[model samples]
Target chain A: MRRQVMDWLEERTGLETAVNHFLYEDIPASAGWHQVMGSVALFCFMIQILTGLLLAFNYAPTPGEAHSSVRYIMTEVTGGKLIRGLHHWGASMMIVVVVSHMVQVFLWGAHKKPREATWLVGIVLLLLTLGFGLTGYLLPWDNRAYWGTVVTTQIAAKSPGLGAQIERLLGSENGVGVVTFARFYTMHVMLLPLLTTLIVGVHIYLVRRHGIAPAPNDTAPKKKFFPGQVFKDTVAIFIAFCVLFALSVFLQAPLGRLADPTDTTYVPRPEWYFLFLFQTLKFFEGPLEVVGAHILPGLAIGALAMAPFIDRGQLRKVTQRTTAWGIALLAGAAWAGLTIAAMRSTPPETDMHAGLVDAPEWQSLSPEELAGLGHFRKQNCHACHVLGEKGKAIGPDLTASATKRDAAWHIAHFKSPAEVVPGSSMPPLTLPERQLNALAAFMLQLKPGSGASLDSAPDAVVNGAMVYQQQQCGICHQANGFGMKVGPALNGLASRRKRDWVVKHFYEPQMMVPGSTMPPYRLPKQQLQDLTTYLMELPARAPSRD
Target chain B: MLAEDSETSRRRFHLGVIYTLMGTIGAALGIPAAGYLLVPGSSNRKEEWVEVTNLEKLKAGEPEEIVFRRNRKDGWKILSEKTSAWVTKKPDGQVIAFAPSCTHLGCAFHYDEKHKNFLCPCHTSTFDLEGKPLEGPAPRALDRYQMKIEGGKILLGAVVKSQES
Candidate 1:
């Protein structure tokens, strides 16, 4: 594509091409293909820019507003998806084409001699382009994009000197905690695009001045860009657009869960093209870390900028520039490999005793979680945790438990455990004062159930209410037709089950329903008694006519 | 053909260069010029206090409805005939005007006898007699309007941004 463009611009250059081989001593026999590819990539980027701007007018960047705003675009904007979809695919294509451009440059040894300045400037353009792509990566504010950027910035802090400082400058210290999504969102839409366009002008200017490097082996008459290469370029671009359209229509980008700051399990990772650099930073863990993370990349760029000056060599053919090409190949491979490995890698297992309960699963629980066996037994926790061994093991066997999670993790897990620990047989616990402090402190320490007491007699009605929303029994079992139809109505369940059996059944509802959606709820002994006693004794709230 | 053609081309190129430079300068100055034109040409004229409620009609402690209007020269020049607001009269002749909207979530907070506080059913963020957060997550107190008594009725000042802290 670029060749087609250059062909049009330098149509007159070939006037003397047949006279002397001075312009391109090594224009390849198949130099035509390279021009075709560049033309394709240029059009893709323009699509991204245009779509991104249109989408910007409707997008909101704040943490609270991000998700709702996106919903509005999807449901409200007339053909908003076309605009958003293009912006999305455009970003993806930007990474794709930029990479393809780099590869073409690298494989051909276009970074040599007279083209050395061009090669260096092109490298800067690549980095700037990637930076633009990454900043835009978070604008949709989906859980994946938001967390992915957060995780990337943390890795960026490994850059030494300015790493931590820059992280703060990016607004982390200002308590970006939940707000960083909004901050990155604004930069992605408003700031980075503006900077990208300005720098793009410079990148293109330098390209025009130095001109494209010809392919590796030509000792004949050079071709004219206009009318000849231009036609070829247009044909190539048409093909590329056809491919882009196919991709946009056939493979829509998945919109992951909404931007959930509370979601710790969201493993942050950038788009695939960035995987190599992202992964490589992992090895820079200690003192040499700065070298791998920042210094090396910087030195590589510095070398690029200094290329025009370094090789005072008398050669014009990039085919002869072995050393520069070698360096470029190594840098590209390093980043690509590192990011790939990072994507494949998983964090090492943690210990429950380690005090670093930052484990993904554990973050959901508060200090008062009924994960303690005593609370669990009262809540009939093991009726499900014990799993195939029969009964409920409300709290899964604590054996090797800490390996999967951290302490703080327990906080997030407990909120609506169904959200965190979905299929486990444990019912969700909804406690009411029942020796609350004692249970929080001692229940976990006691065996599954040591018969914990309550603050008072069970208010069966309130306990029944708890059972409804907590078990999300309300979600499925419509007591009289309000809940999801997935489960049978619980309206008359209290009238059906016997007292002792009802008590035991309440211990673990899953025992009856083979594939129940309910999780292990470690209710305290009193609350358990309260709920069972309440449900068993209910006269159905006296059908009020009002 | 040598000297004459070269001389003409050079002159044309110089003139082109001059025109481009002048055009660039004009564009650079265009932004500020546009901004200047958008602003109001002069200072704001003094505003007159409008009558809100009858002084004798309002009783002590009991909030009375005050309705009035204001005339201004600038934006919204037509005299507004009437608007309603709550006014409290003091024995010494001080009148306080306040909006009925609650500060917390913007729902009107009614006095609850049992709780002895202004209760909000939404999340139960209770407020004190002065409409401050007594129980819930309200960041600020209810807004009180700036006002004064003139002739026989209370006059309300312009609404301004509140510094909740």
Candidate 2:
């Protein structure tokens, strides 16, 4: 019945030939199978548009109600959870699609010669897609989203003369509040989507006009677009939608917690795609930091935009387009490296277990885990849990713990801490099996080694540490002398905390800390873990904390 | 030979004439278009006895709403309805209307009765009871209107956004 109706509409529109004969008649259906990710990405965007509209029905952009209104959508409105899930995952999938699309374009040298316009349009669409994600991110009014936006927009202020003005234009001069929320909301839902949609249309139109480049073959004629090309495209689209539907349904997107503007304890990080840029920002000093973070990025974009006009070359083959290909990969790789380095670089106290965690504020430490940390801290865990005199005073601080204690000893020690040592204040951790593991993970890696900070510039290390200090990262993820009582100490975080765990915590601390006094961080993952690693190195003796 | 020479001369003359006409037309049309597109059009408007509005909904001493299409660059465009703002009338029957736009540039001023003046927090520009410039670097007072009542509803027939005292 659906096919008949669709066929009727196609006939009425005279699109039967266009859809069936011109686009999809001859291409092998199976060969286009792997373009599913792109199809899923595009469908996810459509889903975002639909669900976003539904969310807009209930979402109030005013500062006071923004957070609560989103809560209402999530908990009260019909299918609000699904809508939010679609929006969040749609954003993630869009990034994935854009990356995949760019790779395809590059590997095929589609960016060369007459197709530079197509490449340029694709670049713009990618950027607008990311921009849409960035601006809309703050709309949810969650901790990571809000503060992450705040941190990202501050880079706009690095443009020297126009920086502050652009920042004010993007956000209200004061901060991300009612005006900012409304503005970001408009850009996200209206302006950005419109711009992206228009550009995406242009990208598609150009691609269709100049059909897919034929591989180096001798005899076969170019395939028409109808059933030949679009069948493949449609099949690709269907596979992609299935993956998106699976993601949206089976694994609901991560909406960790609401943002607190005043609570600076949590570190915010962007999605994985943004990790490279976040990492790239860590390589410079003060002004250089600005260039690396914001200026060069803008220039790179401007260059990409101007590519059609600049690279007056006649190359079409992928081999001939090697220079451009290298540049594209280099750009991606550079960012990835910086991000990895940034994630690995921790300042002084990346130690997860230290006396640096004072009082009742247990930050990154989970609730049941907090009970364990509290037990350890109440007895001055740092003084005793000494890893070469860096942790507690009375006991052995964890080092080579994975090797030394191994999984069995670690589990046994947590179940009976004094069993590890006679005078250990670490009491027996008696929780359900899962939480016991989380706490055990927290406990097993207590050392004062630097996290990712070892790979970063000293100044960047200092700046990240400074941000940590100003935000009072220690309030939760504590360093040595400076920090609050929420999250556990960062000293020895490198040796103890897995990089993935630290990054995840940075993405949403509450996932680690329920009933967490520590706010979820909205900083990019690279920045989050950079600061995390810095804190990991703080040994009750690190100089920065002092 | 003579016929060929004459034809060539005629072709050259036609080309010169077309080029001259094209050049002249472009000169006449292009300058103002470029200016309008690129430059901020002169925002100057003097305080004249402009019609505030003749509408029944408008009441004396109370602010009323008025809206109409504005002739912006392209053509008459539909302005946002919210841009139709509140303007307080004066004591006399000839109503004295004040633009809700703040005196320090044209941002919508929130009426702060507590402070007894309109405030623009962008640079802390303030205006007095009748939209007189009270503080800040505003060049002049908020624009006022010469209003009259007509029918049962307030009809804002004509209004201009400006900083005329």
Candidate 3:
């Protein structure tokens, strides 16, 4: 019955004939493992489309909600970590596969004669892949994404006469803000995808028209592609999938602190693929920055696009293509060298990621000190000064402020910044004496390695925060502005229950709150106590505005 | 044979006409889309004076970093952005406000009290109190904001690029 149905469908649409044409074509006998990269790349692209569409369902494109939405995906969605991880790793995998395909094509002199158009289209696809990377990176709206884009726009703004115009077009007139986010989202999910899909169709058509490039001086008879080359391609694709899946499961994608427009301290570094270009910019300073920014890169792309035309020799052997080989070798070495140099020169501090709020020692602070922390936030002190790992590092880090200055000095410096320390960029802070005293006290307590345990106050509250983060309670319950709203807001939990009751609730969530989606947090006694104390203190502590 | 050649020439001409029609349609759709994308980013921003601080608050010959918020239209959103400038009240009562970004690569420059110069930490680019590039990779003097003293309040306008060294 199935065979009869298939025959009927084939009679109407010629679907079976088309399948036969596609699957049973005569491939060059030389096309074995070497030709599998193209199929592998196509497989990765399919994965991207599937995963990207899944991501688009939940991803909020606006600047305000993009970070939170990404966090929502990572923490709240079912199998979100795996899904997002696959998408993240898949991007790099796609780039790797696509580049390998390109390299294989280049080395084999496959981009010659009738296949020149195919090579050209392949270059466009390669660029579109990179375009996908560039646009997709900003969707998370994290610190790295924000700063990396700033660097990108700045680089664009340096391109000779049309620099500012290009920057504005890429970002916006005012700078990277709402428009930039929308622009990138549109490009990533809409424009680029559409263009890439259409171009890829043309690319495949050309590839099919030309068939696979034969080996240099190949004498082997052509063979059917059905079982031999198809099997090799399938194996390669399966292996690629395994590697991608393993990476997705093991190494979760990083979500840095949210983007801060006022942050000038962030050292923006591009993704690894663009590191060579980033390093090259450092060499060409000031007037010649245009060379590194646009001119040289432009020339290279131009040369690559015109490669088939430039190297018109019929010979396919590497030995015969001396000039091409020489140029390609030098360029490859230089790119690798620059990328390595960039990697080596990157500062170690870029890896330092900290929670958005609350340092470890905050738990040990007096009420006055806690109030001072509030004052610090209210004053927007983080715009310039870094506390713990949070905030910009434009000014001296406040983590070791106590070791550097006495409370009296700090107070004096706050009152008359330039007078206390000449050439100080700190503006004159004219606060009431009480607030100043609280701020000074707060600063005095900030010593390096001053853990919450060091002080007598129930600083275990900070330790409780650590427990909360480690336990991933934020995935379900939100306190203040952090975490999702899947469960009840923990803002006024103390009002809802006593400490003992809260601790009991943690141990038996379903028992306390029937139909609670949250599973019981099987934490140690000390952790429960700390967590309860943190909840108890939540009422007194004001909700974070940011 | 001659009649056949004429027929082939007519066919080629028709194909050329078809391509030109297609090209015209493409341009009609494409040009506007390109403009739509580019125009928003490339619009000339109008400069307006915004009150920064009271003139009395700034000490003479000393630079004070003044932070203020400006409501700027960014695409569909009107966002209030926090921006700052290094304002120096000259001994002669001439208030000069330097753009916070350094002339070299736009990193935030801090006024170094010990060196009595503006220094950018990124490349160690230094500028004197007069905004002249004194040391390092700064290609020009520090750019200054156009300022007008209205009554007792110091208002800053557009940033004016300084002459390159």
Q: Which residue pairs show collisions in model 3?
A: A363-A459, A422-B113, A423-B113
> After best superposition, candidate 2 residue A95: deviation in angstroms?
0.6
The runs of at least 3 residues in candidate 2 whose Cα sits more than 4 Å from the true structure, single-residue gaps closed, are A1-41, A76-78, A216-219, A306-325, A345-546, B1-165
Model 3, span A24-139: residue lDDT tens:
89888778888899989988887788778767766779988887767666655555656678789999999889988987777778888878899999999999999999888888
What's the lDDT for candidate 1?
0.54
lDDT tens digits, residues A266-328, model 2? 567765677677777767777588778768788988877776666665545567678777887
The CA lDDT of each predicted structure is: 0.54, 0.57, 0.75
Where model 3 places Cα greater than 4 Å from the true spot, the runs are: A318-325, A349-545, B1-165
| Model 1 chain A poorest ten-residue lDDT run | A351-360
Q: How many clashing residue pairs appear in each of the predictions shown? A: 60, 93, 3
Give, for candidate 3 chain B, the lowest lDDT window spanning 10 residues. Answer: B36-45
| lDDT-based ranking | 3, 2, 1
Docking class of 2: incorrect
Candidate 1: TM-score of chain A is 0.56
Model 2 achieves a DockQ score of 0.01
Model 2 chain A lDDT-worst window of ten: A448-457
**B-chain TM-score of model 3:** 0.86
Q: Per-residue lDDT for A1-546 in model 1, tens only? A: 988876775686774555333323333344666656555566666776666655565666666556555555543455554455656666777677776776666556555666665566566667767777777766666666677777767756655667778777566654344556656766766676677677667665665566666654455566544434444655565555556656655654455555556645446666777666666666677667777667877886776566656655554455566775687678667666676577668453221112211122211222133223234446664444431133322343332142245544544454457777777544456764432332343323322111222112233534544443455554555443344667665544666766676566556768855677656556777666655654454332121111
DockQ order, best first, reads 1, 3, 2
